[model samples]
Target: MSNYKFILSGGGTGGHIYPAISIANELKSRFPEAQFLFVGAKDRMEMEKVPEAGYEIKGLWISGIQRRLSLKNFVFPFKLIDSFLKAGKIVKQFKPTMVIGTGGYASAPLVKVASAKGVKCVIQEQNSYPGIANKFLAGKAEKIFVAYDGLERFFPKNKIIKTGNPVRQDILNVSANVEEALEYFQLNKNKKVLLVLGGSLGARAINKLIEKELNFFAENNIQVIWQCGKLYYEEYKKYENKNIKVLAFLNKMNLAYTAADVIISRAGAGTVSELCIVGKPVIFIPSPNVAEDHQTKNAKALSGRNAAVLVKEVSLDSRFEKEFKSIITSETRQKELSKNIKKLALPHATKHIVDEIEKILKTL
Candidate 1:
């Protein structure tokens, strides 16, 4: 039993929360004796998700700084101070050996406090372009694990480690039975499937565009596997047709990925990592609601390499079908995209991140 404790902080969205939990799970697997704790914003998704993932979590009063001057901005300083103090108290009580921040508003205060306490601290940055919190803590962070390059523009070169993004193991195991997957979704065997995803809560812009062009699939005789997300499922559920399967969520993403001919998605970092592992041709519709426009940057990294197509939110309705047809209809384009995106997969991201932690322990 390794008698060490670690603190993990990340929240607000699933992109930030899931990666933090994945790394925590890896560490716990490697050192079952180590105690772990997660810190997240009080009302954020992580408050529920981290606990459901079978870990203890503390809530912070912290939230992201508003782009425009809102009433919330007036209390931002107080919230930061309170969160910092609370995180400091938690660190003191826990006496953790290491602290890991996965990049969200709550992570900033917790990791900052831990670093000040001289605890070994690291951060996992999921995107090519990092959030304001990650960028703020870059210098203080003992090491920085990033999913892409040019982060040196934001973080120190000496501290940055390119470990890529961690995804659910099941998602990578899509190499299993394609016939079974098609049957599981009850999808047509002959029709090319177009899987549309917009993260967990969902994207309104993506939802509206798909609703506006609902007939496009029938017109083209294309099969659709749409993960409408929880927020929009009730509104969009009525549009379900023989050629379309609308799901609020799918536990068997491996089946969904295996059955899809082309993917239409919001380009969150974790999703990009999973898509790369699934090796499917993708059209990225980066959500504009996220901080720092990180999703767009993440999409650009692949689209810039000709590995995927990028459809901006504003241009989605006009360009989605054209781009969709090009990829879905052309086997050559699909093959090229699959091969190119696979080059970016890091199936063993957890292994590398764990190795870095061990290296830190040895140096001590």
Candidate 2:
């Protein structure tokens, strides 16, 4: 097989960054001689994360338009034009045979430039509701990899493929025993474990809600594995008691997933994919501050299928306790949620997406 050059672009959040990394890793394993380049927004998390994943990356001077009126909105047009010109230069110099985008502001320019150059481009849409960047690129993309059904509304039907989202390889083969995981986290094996996740940067609403309910969890004999995330760890670390283990981040998410009987989490695309694979009963608290209110749409997709419970951030104060109590108190409900959610797990998503990419390249 001949060596191929490829460019991958995505950023802004771990949701976009991790999927891009996962896809790159899969491609590297399949094509050992492949040369890879990652393009991302300058100063974004992807600039830091892509290199850490052992890939060379270039950053574009780009950012998303803010929802509310701000000074950033006024400069959006100039940034977009500059990013497009820069992206065109990178694509011309790199001469990549194909470009793949997971979805972010950085991806918009790179994929657009690649497509204009007559290079094959593929985009992966991780959510049920597509982001503006992906939706815009979909028309010119050779293939559109999606995690959910009914995306024909956003992309051309002929170009759409239901390949799911690429998740961390470590999570795909989670084999930790429940008892071993409980012991590893230094928690009681007898008490039910409630794992709380609010993404890597953390959710202010979820963190505050968990703080108020710490005593209730203790009284109910529930052991807590709270990942307060990096941003909120300092503010909430004082709540760490015998029943609660607070962490800024959990590197060994497989252990945490194995240890948990139930989960309280935000409904980011990557998290939702991992949770489906973990097969635990979960109460989703979707972050409201995201673009297109996509997190709420993601949570509703699973909840609509009777796979998980959806609790809006605004309703956390009144609905959290009642919703959580119902699941924790009933084994039948827990089992039902677990079984239904497991049905949604596309364990071979990374491989399937790569297969589509290869098919598209062959046609090209």
Candidate 3:
């Protein structure tokens, strides 16, 4: 029973990769003898990240279809058929007790094949709007784990579980010592600290906005810990000075959360979940480039509940400073936002997800 094999598939972005890692980690803790095999699209971030998390992963020759007419789109059908055959082979070889899809194009073929082969499959949707893969697998997946409401429209209402999004375990404990965090970042204790996060790869618009507003932050006596992301670090590193700490990625994110008095971030689902758990006042600038603009919807869910502030990328130049100044300048506003946002946190999300996984395992 403890040696049950599990197959987890999803990737392309950190949004999908991190959640799958979190779930795998939790399952490992519960059943240390369990085998985990991750399946992802070759050359995707998951190919690198899953291994970093100490799990073995196999890559499929898969990629998403281009929206516009292109050579890539032309080859998509052949790729899909090839991937489906490979996924069927993987299912037959792995003989996994369960298959979990987090959300991405890579998960589609694998989950579809696994379910067709009568393997139990479950999926966790990280965004407010479900991705194409998750939507396609809805009918076949045994359970659908989701972070937001109103998804019954897309998935079977009976199978949907609103468990919130799974975030890193360290982030759940981010309320730890603020002074130590400040020291770790080498930040000034006298000034308000602002944490800037663009997703894992970095958001171009958010990075540009941060660069343009450096003078504004200095004028307001704010010190910043900016995680401009790996891709944007070189471009933004020149702006780092005594008051600003620029990082490609914050390996110590719990410390980053503790150090921040106010956070400005792109509203990716995983980031939003972590932010809610961190309980910091935030200004959400969602990426419009994403499918269905789900980031905006994720941010709006909290903003509508008075849990966070929503500032769209398009309106940032005109409204960001005003919104940011309002939150940072007022203790009452910060406290209110922090309190409301924390209330929305499902700190035990990983545990709950594993609990459900265990229930399915028992049936096996």
Better of 2 and 3 by lDDT: 2
Candidate 3: minimum summed lDDT over ten consecutive residues — where? 167-176
Model 1, TM vs. native: 0.97
Q: Where is model 1 more than 4 Å wrong at Cα?
A: none
Model 1 lDDT tens row, 54-128: 999999999877889799999999999999999999999999999999988999988888999899899999989
Better of 1 and 2 by TM-score: 2
Candidate 1 lDDT for residue 170: 82
Quote each prediction's TM-score: 0.97, 0.98, 0.97
Candidate 2 lDDT over residue span 146-209, tens digit each: 9998889888999998977788888989999988898899998789999999778788888898
Which candidate number has the best TM-score?
A: 2
